[model samples]
Target: MHLLAHRGYHAKLPENTLTAFASAVEVGFEGIETDVRVSADNEPVLFHDRVAPNGVAVAALTRKQLSEVCGYTVPTLTEALDALPGIWWNIEIKTPAAASLALPILSDYDSSHRLLVTSFRHDVVLAAAEMLASDCGLLNAHRPAALSTLLHAALPHPNLRTLVWDCEIVDPDILRQANALGFRNAVYGAKTLYEHQLMQELGVHTLITDYPQYVGLLPG
Candidate 1:
């Protein structure tokens, strides 16, 4: 199983910062998982929430403005791609606007099969599917409504490759079915070594965690 650094070694560093991402790569994580939100100019910024410093919405600020506000030097998605290389990337589109914004930037790179784009909004995945060769994940799909949407994506879209799920609420049969339909699975929040080992035994492909070094697995 591969270990993904959740928001790039956020166990100690600021989430989604370039420093955090570089540290994860240095620690030999197989992949980096980061969030994307759009600025007023439609540039994709690496941040997890709509709200920025002083209650300003991330979408309302330009790149120059949002950079100094996100608690770290908030890099644009393109900047991140430039900074980190030779590893898989799980890029989560946090808003519908970002779904559109990220695709254009992603298309500029010959990203190979290393990019897995995801979002809570299935429309975002659908939007990505229309353009990129990258695999897509059905994000946060353990809830009832989201699971319904995930089931729909699995039926016809072979590129919808993973389900980013809450580990505790998973149904093995559902995962079996999803796998049967060509979807791999990745679980979030595996806090302990035992839990990580359990996922390894479960044959899970990826586990998103804060402490990749503590999981007792070799780097992929």
Candidate 2:
């Protein structure tokens, strides 16, 4: 089982900021989950939302211009790789086009040994699996009803390694079913220490949490 810092232990710093990521590593988290969106220049930047600070959509601004307006520059996918060492990355491709922008970066890192590409967009995940081929592990994010659809779409690909389930959608039966399918299951937003521990006991192999320290795996 693994404890992942959601948005890099967001309670300790701004979500998705370098400071937050570093704090997660310093606190002994093995994996960090972050989101990726493409800038106008088609550069893969680490940001979850499509809208920028000044009310402009990210699609409308060049990567350079976006950084200038947002104050904190968006870190490229490569920059994240350079910033965090030894820790595994749960990089979520937020849009269909992001697969193209992120696939090359994943290849350049070529250390698929340490990367897991995930996406809520099944098409994007499938495209990335095809693009990266056997070079990386792919994870699909799904709700209960959509799980079967995701499985049918991704099972033929050997690179699709895991399934991340929404916390509210998870049940004991589903956990067993996912395990039978040979996919590891993960839960997100275990808000407290007890909740986190209980989820681990419930056979959740990975947890994405805001309070990493509360999980008792990191220094509070």
Query: Highest lDDT: which candidate?
Result: 1
- Whole-structure CA lDDT of model 1: 0.79
Q: Over the full model, what C-alpha lDDT does candidate 2 score relative to the true structure?
A: 0.75
Whole-model lDDT values for every prediction: 0.79, 0.75
lDDT digits (tens) for residues 1-220 of candidate 1: 8888888977788889889999898887888999999888878889887888769998888877887665567888988888876788889988877877788888776464378888889788877876777788777745563445557755566677788877787656666766776779888878777777777777778888887667556323
Tens digits of per-residue lDDT for model 2, 1-220: 6878888866746678788888888787887899888888888888878898899988778889887986776788888888885788888888877777887778776544377778777677777777764322344344557457657877878877577876766778878887888877878866667777777777887877777666565323
Model 2 pairs in collision = none
Number of the top candidate by TM-score? 1
TM-score of 1: 0.88
Clashing pairs for model 1 are none
